[model samples]
Target chain A: GQQVMQIPQYQHVQEGEDFTTYCNSSTTLSNIQWYKQRPGGHPVFLIQLVKSGEVKKQKRLTFQFGEAKKNSSLHITATQTTDVGTYFCAGPPHRFNKFYFGSGTKLNVKP
Target chain B: EAGVAQSPRYKIIEKRQSVAFWCNPISGHATLYWYQQILGQGPKLLIQFQNNGVVDDSQLPKDRFSAERLKGVDSTLKIQPAKLEDSAVYLCASRRVRRDGNYNEQFFGPGTRLTVL
Candidate 1:
């Protein structure tokens, strides 16, 4: 079975502070996708990284895939109150049929 | 274009009872998925359908849970004789299939929150 692990199960920071969450897997992935779910809301797709050592940015958030393709990270710069939500990383392993999701990292920013 | 749609945003049922949830994916989307999300956890895939045909259902509890996607446009998930531990939010998502036969960028619906008492 394939498994993905996320670090810092929960994080709380000041509105102006920064936050980062890491996603790691024991097996390499063909592609990785990021999602955010607000309290009482459904999960929303954030981004997807497929190539090794790939990096993508969306406004204040930056996502990076490890050179080895088995790890990834999401970093938020100068978080805002609206950034409160849980972030999850998911991907399917090579030659696998189903995708696996990380436990998720909940983020809370104080005003 | 409209996003995925799910009915009965919330539900409450007693143990051993039965419940069902419905979902309609966006038009032209060929892949649909059902996931279970417990409080404080990520969504876990229960089943996946590719155009009315099941692609994966290894995680589904076939004895107590059953799902169907008739005509490849709408889907329904049913739970029979539910238990307390079955309480969770069921989410439905859909993705567009590319010409290369790859699917990406899943869009999720609001989800149905079920409480088993």
Candidate 2:
């Protein structure tokens, strides 16, 4: 079975500070996706990384895929209060159709 | 466009009782999934369906949990003699078919939060 491990199970930062979370998988993945879930809300798709050593950005947030395709990271520059939520990384273990989600990093941005 | 839909945004039940949840994916989406999220944890995959056939359910507990996607449009998850540990938020998600073979973009519903005492 494929599994993903996320570092810093919880993160709290002052407004305007930076935050980062890393995700590593046990097996090689075809691609990796990121998601965000607000308190008591369902997860919303954030972005997906396909190519090896790929990097993408959205406003102040940046997503990177490790060259090995088995690791990924999400970094938020100058975090804000709206950035409070749990971030998750997901990828298919094999062709089995089940995507394993990382334990997740819960962010609490204080203003 | 309408997003995934789930019935009974919240539910409360006693242990040993039975409960059921329903999900209606976005129109024309062929893939459906169910996940359970405990407090302070990420969502765990419970089942996956491609149309009317199941693609993976290796994580489902057959002894007390069961799910079916009849007609490949709507799905149902049922738990009999539920235990207190069954309390969690159940999320339903759907993805549009991708010929490129990439299915990382999935839309999730508001989720049905269950509390079993």
| lDDT score for residue A110 of model 1 | 95
* Candidate 2 regions with alpha-carbon error over 4 angstroms: none
> What would the per-residue lDDT of candidate 2 be over residues B1-117, giving only the tens digit for each residue?
999999889999999999999999999999999999999888899999999999889889999999999999999999998999999999999999899877759999999999999
Predictions' DockQ, in order: 0.88, 0.88
True contacts kept of each: 0.94, 0.97
lDDT of 1 by residue, B21-97 (tens): 99999999999999999998889999999999999999999999999999999999999989999999999999988
- Candidate 1 at A12: error in angstroms? 0.8
Per residue, candidate 2 scores C-alpha lDDT tens digits across A1-111 of: 578999999999999999999999999888899999998788999999998999999999999999999999999999999999999999886455568899999999999
Give candidate 1's TM-score: 0.98
How large is the interface RMSD of each prediction?
A: 0.9, 1.0
Residue A75 miss distance in model 1 (angstroms): 0.4
lDDT of 1 by residue, A58-82 (tens): 9999999988889999999999999
